[model samples]
Target: MSTSLKIYDTTLRDGTQGEGISFSVTDKLLIAQKLDQFGVDYIEGGFPGSNPRDISFFAEAKKLKLTHAKLAAFGATRRAGVKPEEDAQLRTLIESEMPVLTIVGKTWLMHVHEILRTTPEENLAMIEDSVRYLVAQGREVIYDAEHFFDGYLDNSDYALRTLEAAARGGASNLTLCETNGGKLVPEVHKIAAAAVARFGRDKVGVHCHNDSGLGVAVTLAGVDAGASLVQGTMNGYGERVGNANLVTLLPNLFLKMGRTANCAKNLKELRDLSLFFDELANLRPNPKAPFVGQSAFAHKGGLHANAAQKVARSYEHIDPALVGNRTRVLVSDMAGRTSLTLKARELGIELDERLPAMKGLIDELKEREFRGYEYEAADASFRLLIAKWLGQQKTFFDVENYRVIIERHNNQIWSEATVKLTVNGEAMHTVAEASGPVGALDKALRLALAKAYPQLQTMSLRDYKVRILESNQGAGSRTRVLIESGNGKKIWGTVGVSDNIIDASWEALRDSVEYMLMQS
Candidate 1:
């Protein structure tokens, strides 16, 4: 068998099926180009003629000059009884001018009869005619035998017939889909081998869902059975649980399974690509998600940190740097000096391992922990604190006084804020308005220092999160604020804890600005 495998990505199409996952036309085009950069074989542009957004996305996507990855327009076979050429969906697929058109057709007889409202033979005819029509139109077709696993389990002979029909119609590939994601690895192994026996090994593909949390396992098992194409989405964003997570799957296939694919040559971009898509969709990157997640290579336990520092593979599966991620030693209750030193080293802190100050730092961290401050999720703040302790930190400006006024009038809420600050003994005051006191205060602070730092033009607050810490004095409870700031090229999180939410936000906001300046 050839070691080469074809990687088909459905992030733009099937990925949007995931709840709260959406991409604008521009976002779709950018992702397509990134996918091309990542060296995937194909990127499905979504089902054209189904919605205005998809239609617009295909138009813009076709304009991008991709280096790798074929642009594929997705659609179903012609309606129950219609010519593929005259059908609007198929016609739109052709008009999109994508290099390929991926068409799904009924495979399970139950779907053919019940959902499609057509006889089993008619459904077969639809598959054959649609693939043939697209082929005749000079478009490469990948026939998706949707529900193939379930269909094969219910009616093996009929499911095999569907693949044969698509093959006769000139489909370049026949993909077996675990539609409901209910198939286990053993079932995938068995059914995929049968698919190869019936349709030959050259063109069989595997597409799976994550309902059973075994999408990647099942896909690998199918590959073991000689299926050459792996269909999935980045981070497994799809309907229900999700599609197989390409973030985890691709690295495994290349490093462990030794499967040759385009992306294998560019493993370094894997983590960046995964986070890029998540940020674009305004979704929080899953901390516990497989290979590309934040926690993938994070070590918290003292023993694990010690062993990992000496020999990384002791606690890590691979050198995280190979995938554009680094081993992160987290500071937690289970952490020791090793963890602190590892984390401090990341921020360029050169605290001596044997120094007595090491224990003092640890004590300080524990005291802060008791004060409702968490550093695990806010490294930027931790770094700033470390810099301050080492006397390496700089203060560009000092806040002397700040006030915010919020009131309701004319049935609309209004807020204004003022800040008094000093830079190098010179005093300055600025005022601004926003929908909320935090925004107004942030604006006021920035306006005050706008003249001192112009690079601030490139940065913006990405997200703001607030949580109330439990206290015996309920009315005087303290709050913790976490602010995510991004400079278009990178993002960092800072933390603040105080009795007043405004004070907490200001602390985080100040740290965020200081962190960015320190980098600049």
Candidate 2:
């Protein structure tokens, strides 16, 4: 029988520390419940004494009747001079009443002397007293030996003494941490093997960081060397370069190694789990992340797509459905007849082999791509391209003419935009004034379209990103604008490119309205 590994998730605690990520108490509770449903062994909610939100999250998590996972409250070990029983932080950690408690203690001599301004012996005493106090309070304590890898390399005897203190203090587990995240795979294996040899396998754990981009590799090396518990955050959110990403590590442990880890929850739900957090955090999901990314299974080369169609194992490592992703054949200039036919079939469009329109559309896409229009990132434009080629697109209104006026008056700027549009053979004109040219144009366009398409009023731009394509200097700098719009249930992205920002924004806005109408 394969041994089941423990999955310790720190998304609530460490993930929120990621730059620009903040979660409310309710958000923390939701993530905790979802992680429970996903079969994680433990959920580290947050450090209770660190912030008011975290303190509230601990109180809120206590009220939840979690079915499978144990909630862990996190905090630092006691101060150098104070006893664990006397330290307010340690007392607060106990008062949180979580079933599990994780306390980080200094392991590196540099941190002891420089950061903590304490003697090495005092640091060891803090670890010992904190673990004993938490354990004595009926809490399962996991002592995180912060900077254990570096500490071991610096002074093997002192690092070993720290682990011995936690063990002697009845800590349920001693987690070796890579604080700076610079340890290579070989160094990880060597240190982990030595720690296991000294502490025995059951008492050891691994907490990795990603500063050097080796978190995942180092984590795997730790497990291979004999770690019973692996600690990391989902999507690798943390202070600096982020913590180790367990989303990438779990599948490698369970699927690749064929080790049983009790992850009976739908492994296919990994993608949704990843994206759900991204949405809540108001961040764009990384498209290149392994297993759950948008392009994880996307195939583009003609030879690769043909091989993938024949036997997915030829080009793909495994079936994407195993992780709840579908194989995609991107339509681009490199797409051959086989790739095009597959794309059409997936879209429910039947194309005759000899259709001139099909070839013409492919040629147009190639020509446009060379001119700075990227269809891959702009699915709205790609869909419109297909609809136009099929003669199935409907234009609710035609824009006859538009002009933007910018004037400088008395050391201030004034802007006005006017749009003349024809809707169903009736002409309408609207004018709007704003602080800037782009805002004025948006107001005018919305006012003109609102009369005809009432649904357009419900839709708004959620995000707008601009990128310059060619940087050949002032006169000929080609620019592209990617606009993301939402109508609550679905999000659509459109792209527009031109020398003028107003023109690009107008093109993207026009596509947005058209896409919404198609949805309706």
Candidate 3:
């Protein structure tokens, strides 16, 4: 029977090392579970002995029954002249009781001589001794030859000797690392082919980094050259450019290359997984990442949208459903009638080609987008604009007048806001004081809306972003405020621009409430 390629993920170990990325113990476990659902063969948790959070992750992860993947602990090989049994880090790896352990060892002669400050003979001994000790302790060891490709190119004999040490030491597998990740495809093919020839295909693995932007290509070369195990990170997280993104690489290999049996995962889930990590990290998802990014299947141009509407494959490289991503027909100034018709159908609104309202709405959308009001990002507000254009939106309430009073006390600013509103044919007035003008206005607006729509009491603003359209003019400059509000079930965003920041905030706040009320 043919075997599938083994996917080893190091997102928790290597991904967390990425600049500006730090995962709590709980975050690691959540990501681990997501990888398991992605059909990974192994999940490499961080080095158990290096940090308390990682140690806690290992302890907690082992208690959960993972369905598809085995959790692995990562660490360096034992120190020179020290037995693995006596090494505290190695002992910690064993205590984690994970089914697999990966220990990296020196392969490049330069590293052996300079970084390790040891003779080649001692480096080989370290490799052999470390693997043997781990195997003796009943742990399955994968010996990673750091910088193996560069080492193989510089000194073929020494590189082969390092592998021989691991083979003789009872290592279950030996992985070649492109540690600097500067290698090209031809070089990776050459080295991986030679390693497979020397070590036998079953005993070899590939660990690639993305510094040169060729990590995925190099990994594919290694696989083609008969490396059975591919090690990388989810979303390509790591130091510098990052490791090979297995999320993208896997689908490419499975669907495009036909190398492995379909893992039965909904490819669209990859998007959710990527966004889940971004949310956990409090970072925005990349809009252009392959397979799962926001723009992966988004079409904006008229010709492209028209072509995609007729034959999606003409514009899309692959079916979006293959990776759990949906094609988004973005309506912009460039969008044509085909794009608008498709979007209307998606929104469950009938498309009437001769309707002047439809054409007017498209024109209005283009005009607003020209001023930096991005309907793509402010989707809820865009929906309201669409509904109003169609004469289908209901007016929840009307604002008669509103005023904000700013007072200076002890060199500090205070704001008192008052609003007069008509709700369901009745007029009501309310006043609220807050730390700032916008805060006070928002407080007063919410209080007034709550009287009519009781559900407004549960809503909260989750994120607020402000951008200065032109900053050269300083405090008097016109700025844009983008507000994202959520009520647990749904999220809506709106944008407002003005010279007065308070007015911009009020506009955004009013649009947010109006969008929510329209949804209700």
Candidate 4:
């Protein structure tokens, strides 16, 4: 039988500890649901006793109807001089009603003697009492030996004693942790190999940090040494440098190690999972993250693109589509005719290599790009260019004029804007007031055309980004605005450039509205 490597996800617990990462209770439950859908064996929701948000999260997660993953509640072992039943933290873990309970405790001598301020023997007692109490209460317990590798290095027998304590107390899994994330892969494998020999391979698990950029490497090394279960945060989200990246680890385990997991069928959803999670957190997806990144399968070189178009494996490690991503031959100044043909095909543009229009389109793109028009980031603008040149764009609405004014009274500010629009030979004028200049302008424009274009109500700007183009005149530099808008089903981006910020914003907004109407 193939070895079954269990996947334990700690995104809600450990991931939130990373710098610049915070998720509301709703985000946590949503992420938990997504993780469960992706077929992870366990989801470490949060530390129930840590705070009110986590407590609420556990209460709500019960109603999410999660099917694939068992919910695990995390907390520390019972404190010194307290009975396991008397510890509030342990009680809170039970109250969360999670099927699995994971308790972390001091394993390193320095943490035991200096940080915990408890005797070595007392720490051992704490671990044993905490695990035995939970297991007796019908909880499947997993004992995390905090700083296990470091402790093993300092005092091998003492560290081994901690694992033994948990095992004796009925912990189903003895998870060795590289808490500080400074251990080398070889050191991790050696200690983990010894741990597997002593504890038996089926009982060992590995959790690691990314301080030295070797979290994933060391994690796989531990599995190579005999760990059957792996604990990591999605996208390697954790404190310090971060934890091991399960995005990279999962594929490595499946393809490289030949280990089978429940998530094998869901592996194709890995890219979408990474993107959706990052989007819920309102963070930009890392375009360069291994395997699932936007740039992972992007080919930029002319020679490389030509060869990839012929045979993908010739210039790539594996088929990008294997992980639900596709090969993208980037069209830039370095692009060849073959690459351009591929791009045109992707854009759904019927093209001919013998036609001079393709060459003309390339020249136009390069010229426009030289004047602060970046087609790479402003893909919507590039698409509009192609459609316009092909006579495929529809005429939406025309703007005759617009006016905006801001006035302050009694320490409060109000702005008003007037818009004059011509739609299909009908003239409409409207005025609106709002909290800011942009809001007032948007409201006025929408009011002018809402009667003719009812679909305007469904379109709203999702993101507006402005950049000041570099100029020798310094303060007189031009401004560029990119507006991302979405209807109920689809989203698109549009761009505008002008000397004034308001005009730039207005132009982009107009294009966005027109783009929506065109689709409707």
**Count of backbone clashes, every candidate in sequence:** 0, 0, 5, 0
Error of 1 at 353 (Å): 1.4
Q: Could you give candidate 4's per-residue lDDT for residues 30-102 as a string of tens digits?
A: 8988898999999999888678899899999878787879999999999999999999999999998999999
TM-score of each: 0.88, 0.90, 0.93, 0.88
Candidate 4 wrong stretches, greater than 4 Å: 24-27, 59-66, 300-304, 314-316, 329-332, 335-340, 397-422, 425-454, 471-473, 517-520
Top model number, TM-score: 3
Q: Report residue 181 deviation for candidate 3 (angstroms).
A: 2.2
lDDT sort, best first: 1, 4, 2, 3
lDDT of 4 at 459: 78
Candidate 4 similarity to native, TM-score: 0.88
Better of 1 and 2 by lDDT: 1
Clash pairs for candidate 4: none
lDDT of 2 by residue, 245-354 (tens): 98788777777765556564467888888898888887889999998899998888777888888999988886788777888877777877677666666556666657
**Model 3 Cα lDDT, one tens digit per residue, 1-520:** 2446778888898888899889998888888887787677888998886878987998898887889888889888778777767888888888999988898999899998889888899889888888888888787888889999989988999999999999999998889999999999999999999999998989999999999999899999998898989998878889999999987887788777767733435455777877887888778888999988888999888789889989999999999988888888777788767777776666666677677887788888788767656656676776777788878888888899999999999998899999999999988798999887777888898898786798887788888888887688899888788889999898878888788777777888889999888777
- RMSD (CA, Å), each prediction: 3.2, 2.8, 2.5, 3.1
Runs in model 3 deviating more than 4 A are 1-3, 261-266, 405-414, 470-477
> Residue 11 deviation, candidate 3, in Å?
1.4
Instruction: Indicate which candidate wins on lDDT.
Output: 1
**Residue range with the least summed lDDT across 10 consecutive positions in model 3:** 259-268
How close to the true structure is residue 364 of candidate 4, measured as C-alpha lDDT? 74
